[model samples]
Target: MFCNQCEQTAKGIGCEKVGVCGKNEGVASLQDLLTHALQGLAIVAVAARKVGIVDPAVDHFTAEATFACLTNVDFDPARFETWIRKTVELRDSLRARAEGAGATISNDTPALSYRPAADLAGLEAQGVALNFIPSLDENEDLRSLKQITLYGLRGLAAYTDHAAILGQESDEVYAFLQQALADLTRNDLGLDELVALVLKCGEVNLKAMELLDAGNTGTYGHPVPTPVPLGHKAGKAILVSGHDLRDLQLLLEQTKDKGIFVYTHGEMLPCHAYPELKKHPHFYGHYGTAWQNQQKEFAEFPGAILFTTNCIQKPRESYQDNVFTTGLVGWPGLTHIGEDKDFTPVIERALALPGFPNDEDKGEVLTGFARNTVLGVADKVIEGVKSGAIKHFFLVGGCDGAKPGRNYYTEFVEQVPQDCIVLTLACGKFRFFDKKLGDIGGIPRLLDVGQCNDAYSAIQIAVALAGAFDCGVNDLPLSLILSWYEQKAVIILLTLLHLGIKDIRLGPTLPAFITPNVLNVLVDNFAIKPISATPQEDLQAILA
Candidate 1:
């Protein structure tokens, strides 16, 4: 099984024998099978949609199936097998419905008539056909564009699923996702059509993010300036990680009055900004740093670690038993909470383990500087810029990884002049979050906007800044320093590109799957840059 659909693929190349994310050969192969089946299902769903037979369930399932194949999301082969079967079942049902509705679908497409192997060996026998590496299209450029579009859809699906949990639904986004997936399996579309579709993925991603933002802000209220305690409190505790706010809310509700203190970890750190979740007394401070540091951090923490969504690593033996997964996240040997949302297993584990003996002084980190919060203080920010209190703006944010060069972000943020405001989101901020950058004119120098999805907020903030200054977004004294990990970051970058945002710096390294020609297109159109080895020089280049 070969996979390179993430920032931290093996040696900056595809992962072959085993996933760098700890998905063994079996799980990785299963994910390939799942993705292949989903593409077939897309063929059926897209055909069915052509006949005005819109199946929301089929659309939603495709998104979910794609998400499960994302890096670090799921590593359970059995679960992936289940999803493959489910996707095939849906594909068959949709095909029948389309035929009954007199939809004209060519039976010639291999994707339309895909049959899953009943067993692992059978799955392996049908190997190369199931892999994404072997594209149906012969043109290398078109293949690269198709992959970019497909990965974008996978990222959009994760966002869509999260919003759906909050009762927010967008039919347009779902339809486009289904139609695009089917298009990937089509042999007829040329490079021009594929490139246009890839750009459209960015547009649809913006909509999906908007839906998620509304769901989050509407449910939790716009995140106000809130101080999140970094240290733990004395008591039975549990550390919640990943990006699922709904699961965090349910856990908060279940842990209420139970004496088990709950803490946000990793991407869930922003949950504190939401007033609804923070209002709970048992909901205490944030624990540890980013997802990459989980093994060490989880062991150090005496409480159980609960993963709500992706970015889970292979657990260490010390804390392996203490970890629990829920809501589309899975890892072998770890206890999983089903749809019941009953976090009893996790809560019991927390109770059995010794929590922090006493609250330690780990300092405070600020989050919740989402779009609304920034917009609320728009005038003051505008004044700060006008008065010269704010010199430049650096948006340093993205996924965090164990890769060595990632320290460039930490160094860059550290070197930004005190007068410059640093805007960060997602887990990449973990490197310097504990460092107090101080505030400039009452605005924190280091501002964590929100999770990766909250890049929506940074984009909003950038657009607003441009509007106030009466110039294009690129004309502002702002720099976007992004560190991508998975497909979500891919889609977000595409969105930035779609908005015509230029001179963006991407690192620790560019995606392995992006060929030289594709990179040329990106560099030519968007002027995208690879991060320089020297952070100081990079900073000088940006400030120049």
Candidate 2:
């Protein structure tokens, strides 16, 4: 199995045997097969759409299928097998309809004609040949650019899927996703065409994120400044992780009077800020820190656990039986909730377990400082800047990983001066989120901007600050120190690049797919820089 689609890829090259994230060879190969199958579906979807035949089901399925293949998202080969067959069936259905309308799809394309392996062995054989590294385009630059585009689409699918489930759908986003996927197989495309597609992916992913933000804020009112308890509450408690607000809401609704307490974990920590969701008394407290620490965190948690999306680690035996997965997330033996959204299985396990025997009150941290919350106080922020009270603004946010170097973020945040405000989003904030970074006057030094998708909120805040100051964003005292763990981070980075954001610091390690030439292109064009070895050095460099 050859895979290196994440920041934690083995030695920053490729995971040739077992995935560093604990994905076995079988699971890795199946993910590759699933990725290949989605490419096929995209070819069919793009062709059919041209003849005025747009299947929202096909578009939805394509987005969801691609999402299922994201890093650390789905690891069940059995699930991949089922999804692979479904993809082929969807592609064929679309192809036949298009053919009836005289839009001929040739069987000559290998991607469209792929048959699912009858069993796991056959799946491996099919996938072994479909490894992504081989350059179909002789030009190395074009090939690297193609891969970068595909990675962004994978991220786009994740956001699109979330928005879709919440009853928010964008045909334009879906169309661009399909077309982008199909471009991977197009050998006729030139370098300029591929680069444009990558940027367009950024443009559309921004739209997809906007749709999700709207769906989230519209369904559950815009997040307000609310203090979330970091302590564990007494009673039967369940920890809901990942970034799905809809799942958390449904679980909270069902568990409402059942005496079950639902605590947010990882990316779900920000859910506490929503007025509609937080109104529930049982929706209490946040458990654990970021996604990378889940192995230890999930085990220590007394109650059941529910994963609503990506960044799921292989469950430890101690807590394996107590864990459940829903949405696009999956693991081998975990209980999975379907579209019915009935979490009775998860609820039953929570009740049957021995929850926190004694209340452990750790402390509290304030979140939900989303765009609306920040923009409402734009005048104050503008004043803080003008008066020289808030010296600098650091956006230290993204997904966290298990590597030891991840300590850089914690140490870096530890070193940030008290006068500087820190804006954070996603799970990366877990590094120093609990630390009491004192406020400058009434404004808290550390600001939580909802989930990773809420990077949209962070961007809005930055743009708003620049607008109020009557200067470009770069002219403002702002710096972005981002850490990426999965595909969603990839698209977010691309979106920043597309917007011409410069001099951002990205670490724990760069993507392996980015060859030296590609890295040079980024450095030359975007002025992107890697984090220094010492947090002190990196922090000093950023503030300098």
Candidate 3:
């Protein structure tokens, strides 16, 4: 039951006895088995492709299965057991179809199938099956390289699953995951092949990101600059967390006019900027800072907290009864909202609670109005630049984690030059939310672009700025100093690479899965570097 695929792995290493995320040994082992089975499915899909029989269902199942194994995604061993059985059934069905059609499949890999060992004595009996273990390459470097690619795909699958729930599907991304997963299972492949697949994972993940961006913006309208309230109003309220905008939208709709105020939590904080979502008068401001503060933040709150996706920690008994989970996020004893997307139970609980004595509105928290909204004020922004008011643009954003080294983001934002504008997104901005970074001319110094998915907005703004200056994106005065905590970051990094953007700095710690060979490829190709020294020094290097 050793798992360390996330930032909050127990004790900064693998979670051995029990997952800090509340996943038990059985659930962890099942997730491992599920991952192994998905890889097996990928093997079959890839082989079938060689024979010109590419089943889209096989590709999608692989994506969903891989996504389910992501950190904090599936904690219910019972649910995953069903998924495993279903996957095996799918694999067998696919094989039967191919054989019935008389298609000559060259690769004869066994279908996705596994049985628990006969002896269920202790921890070792429940440990992940050997087949599920990532192949241990003869070369230590290659093993690391395979891990990086595999983990990166796991992250990509998570994002893709979110998009799928919103009715956004990309065949190309699914196909790429199948191809990449199959490639990881191949120990015969050399460093060059694995490296190419690593970069390709990045490329396809970029497309996946674009699809999600479109899904969000197209459905909700472009996010505009809007200030969210920080104070919780009296009465019943619901705190919606995680990164799924669609879930947030549904909750907002169901709770509207019901006297239950909806507030954005964690990554959902950015949803307030969307015109369609913001129009809801009852949509309150953000609740707390980041995911890590949830245990304290959720304590004794007057309402239920609904988790739409990842980054949920095991709840304390005090608030455990009030927490509701929807979509793929699951945990024992938590109320789960099913596929219907109905959130009535959460709304009901919020109403049942004795809310604040009055409508206690928190003060204004600035957000919304990202690139498109900002671009709407493009004339003003361009004028400010021409007037020498807005000097430099600092893109400071990425995931937030429990690691102490994450304090770098706080220090980095605090140290930004007064005249420079700080653009942020995702949970990483929580580090400096209290800072009075001050605005350049009229704009605020800390401008939140949106969620991590809104990295697209950051990219759009950079490209537009490059176009305005008649230069390449890399030549613009903007600098990307990012903090990554998960796979979504991996996809965003790939997008940056796909655009040929260089000199990007990442931190707080480098992924343990990346082998030296793979790291060398990224260094040589993109000049990506780890965050070191003080932010001042890093800023100097980027400016230089």
Candidate 4:
């Protein structure tokens, strides 16, 4: 099994023997098969749509299936095998029904087929390969475009799946995913068509993200500025990691008054900003930094750790027993919290563990100052700008990973002028969030705009500012210096490009899959540049 779909892939190459994310050979193969089957199902769905047959279930199935194959989503081979068999059965049943109906469907139409009632074991044992892998097109440029489009769809599917689980649905985004997946499997498409599809993926992904943002902000009040504690308090504690705020909410609710202190980890660090979530007294603080530091950080921890989503590294034996997975994230031996989202087992484990008798004093870290909170202080911010006290705005954010080049974020944030404001989002800000950058005027130098998805807020603020200044977004005095580590970043980058935003800086290494020609198109069209020289030089370049 060879997989290199994430930043921590072995030695910056494909992971052959075992996944760097703790996905063993069996799990990796199962995820590959799951992805392949989803593509096949997508083919069937697209065909059916041509005949005016649309199955909402099929759209959801494809979305969830694709999401399950994301980097750190699933790692239980047994559960994944079940998912693959179900997907194959679903696809075959749908195909048979379509043929039976003589659907006369167009190649790209969406369709749904029902499955015959049978045990999935037989289907699993057949070892049928879902023939959805796109052949390497002779035109390298076209192949690169297809890769970009496919990866973008993967990112969209992941976000859509999360929103769907929260009872939110966007028919348009679902249709786009089905259409794009089918197109990727088609060898007949040319470069121009693939390029168009790539941009379309961007446009639809923006919708998917907007849907998620609405789901989050509508459910929990808009996030506000709140400082989070970094030190561990004495007594029983549990660390809630990953990006799912709904799960975090449930955990915070259940653990209340249970003598178990709750802490955020990794991407969940920004959850503290939401007014509804922050009001919880037990919602203590963040633990450690990004996902890469987990193996070392979790080793001596005295309580259970709950992972709700991606970026789970291979665990060390010392803490493996204490780690629990919920939602899509899974591992071979880790205890899993299923659909009910019941976290009792994790809470019980936390109680049983010998938690720290004395508080570990790591001090407090600032976070939770998302868009709403910032807007609340708009008057002060505008006044500072008017007074010429705040000279510039820097959007320095994106994903964080184990790669060496990631330190560029640390240096870049450190080099920002004291008079400028640094707006950040996602785990990328973990590098500088702990650094006391102080404040310019009344605003903190480093403002975390929530999680990576909160990049939407940053975008909104930029566009609004541009409107206020009576200029285009690119003409604003704002600069976007991004660091990408996953497909979500890919979608966000495409969204920025689609908006005609130019002269952005991206770094900590470019994607391995991007061809030189495709890179040239990006550079030429958007003036996207890789990070170079010291932070001082890069900051000067952006300021200039």
Candidate 5:
């Protein structure tokens, strides 16, 4: 297995045996095979589109299958086998229709005619033999760019799936996904073409995120400023983690009067600010920090846990029985809730367990400063900036990881000037999320802008602020200090680049997949920089 698509790739190169995320060689190879199959499906799907044969099911499956390959989303090799078979099934179906319509299908690559092995063991062997990552391109530089596009699409697929779940769908987004996947299977594309496709991945991801923002806010209502308890309520409880709101809502409804108090965990923390969700009296406060800390945190929680999306750790035996997974998230033995959205198993498990024995007030933290809430107070923010009370804005947020350098975000947020406003999103905010940064002219100095899934909210906030100041987003006295762990962050960075945003500082370590030549292109065109030796050093340069 050769996997290097994440921030913490083993030894900062590639995970050649077991993945640092606990993905075994079998699962890693299966994921690669699934991705390879998707490329074949994409090639056929793109041809089908030429013949006006677009199937929504094919489009949705393409997104879900690609998303399933994302880091930490699914660890069960069985699930990968299922996805691989389904991808081939869809590809064959599309190929038949397209050929019937006189559209020629490409069989130039083995993926075009590939078939999965009859069993999991055989399939794993097939995947290892056909592994495409190392052999993608003879040119290391072009291979690096392909890696970027591939991972960016993984992130894009995730967002697209999230939006589709909430009844937001776009053909354009689906079309781009197919075309990009097909383009990836080509060998003639040069560096510039690949770079443009990478940027386009970012641009389409913005649309996906916007659709998700609409689905979330339209369904749950715009998040309002709400203070959520870090404390636990004494009773039966179910902790929901990951980034799916619909899963949380379904669980909340099923456990409504059943004495199970639902608590948000990880990225689900922002769900508490949504009006429809917050109205549940049994819905309790947040528990734990980011996804990286789940092993320690989930072990201590007394009740059942439901993981709605990604950010899953290999479950330790102690609490493995207490955990359940739903949607596209999968673990080998965890009870998976199906499309029916039923929470009976989770509810029964919560009932069987002893929840928090006593109430503990760990104080509270404020959230719900998404675009709507922030823009609602646009006048106040504008006035504060004009009066120099809010001298600058620092957007210091992205995916957080367990690496040593992550302390940079916490320390960086600490060093942010008192007069400046700090807007953060995703799990990275956990570093200084609970810090009391006070307020400037009635505006909270530290604003929690929802989850990484709510990145559209953050982008909208920046755009609105830019409009208010009559400047481009890059000119709005804002410095983006972002830390990425997985594919979602990759696509979000691409979106920022797509907008021609410049001078951004990214770190904890740049992606292992980014070749120096490609990094130079980013640096020359966008002035992108690695995080400084110290947050203080970066701060001095930015404030200069």
Candidate 6:
């Protein structure tokens, strides 16, 4: 099996033998089979839509299935088998409906008529024989463009699924996703067309993110400036990680007055800023850093750990039994919380664990500087800019990985001039989140703008700032220094490109799938730059 859909792909190339994310050959092949099955389902779904027969279940299933294939999400081979079978079943059902509606369903497209093997082993064998990655395209540039679109769709599906969970749905986003998947079956498309499709994925992702932003803020209330403790209170505890706010909300409800203090971990760190979530008396402080450090950090946590979405690493024996997965996240042996969202087992385990021995005051960091909070002080920011007190704005954030060279972000933040305000989001901020950058006037210099789920919030802040200054977004005194590790970051970059944002710096290494030709196209068109040899260098270049 060969896979290079993430930044940390083995040796910065395709992972041929095993995944860098700990997905063994079996799990990798199963994920490949699952993706192949979804492409078939998507072909049928797209055909059905043409005949004006669209199934909401089919649309939602397509998103969930696609998202499950994303890196670090689901590592359970059994789960992939179930989803692969379900995809074929859904494809058959949708095809019948489309045929009944007088749609000309053709078997010429193999994906439409593709059949899965009966068992997991057979499915894996079929997947290996079918070989998804190497068969993408012969043209290096076109393949790179298609990989961008494919990964972007995976990220968009995740955001789409999260929004749909909160009762937010958009037909346009679903239509685009299925259509893009269907388009992957075509070999006639050229580089320009594939590039167009890749950018369109970004455009659609922006819409998906908007839907998610509405869902999150609408359900949890727009985040306010709230201080989240880095320390812990002595008690029974459950650390919630990943990016699902609703799961955390439900767990908080289930454990209310049960003596379990729910601590936020990883991307869940920003949940403390949401009024609906934070109002829970038992909802407590944050624990640990980013996803890559989870194996060590989680093992040390004294109570049960719950992963609400993705970013789950292979659990070690030390904390394996103590970890539970909900939503689409999966690992072989760990208990999974189903759609019922009961979280009863998690509570029981938390109650059983040692939890914190005593109160620890590790101080705190400020969060909730989302679009609403930041834009609410637009006048002050505008004034700061005019008065030259805030000389520049650096948006240094993205996914954090275990790879070397990530310390660039830490040093980058440290070297940011005193007069500049640093706006950050996602797990990457863990590098220097606790730094005392102080503030320009009353505004904090280092602003935590929620998780990667809050990319829309950061985008909105930039757009709002641009509007306030009567200039284009790129014309504003801002720079995007991003680090990408997964498909979500891929889609975010595509979104930035879609918005015509230029001169962005991306690093920790460019994607392995992006050929030099495609890289040149990006550099020529968007002026995209790889992060310089040093943060100091990039900072000088940006501030120059």
- The CA lDDT of each predicted structure is 0.85, 0.87, 0.77, 0.78, 0.92, 0.91
Ordered by lDDT, highest first, the candidates read: 5, 6, 2, 1, 4, 3
Worst 10 residues of 6 by lDDT: 105-114
TM-score to native of every candidate shown: 0.97, 0.97, 0.92, 0.92, 0.99, 0.99
Residue range 28-137, candidate 4, lDDT tens digits? 65665566567678787766766666788788888877777777677676777677767867777777677666655343422223231244343333222322223436
lDDT: which is higher, 3 or 5? 5
lDDT of 6 by residue, 364-469 (tens): 9999999999999999999999999999999999999989999999999999999999999999999999998898999999999998979899999999888888
lDDT of 1 by residue, 213-255 (tens): 9999898898877899887788999989999988888888988
lDDT of 5 by residue, 379-413 (tens): 99899889889889899899999878899899999
For candidate 3, give the lDDT of residue 359.
62
Full-model lDDT, candidate 6: 0.91
What candidate 3 gets wrong by more than 4 Å, as runs, is: 8-13, 20-22, 49-57, 106-127, 131-136, 379-387
Better of 1 and 3 by TM-score: 1
In model 3, the number of clashes is: 8
Residue 476's lDDT in candidate 1: 95
Q: In model 1, what lDDT does residue 16 have?
A: 89
**lDDT score, residue 144, model 5?**
94
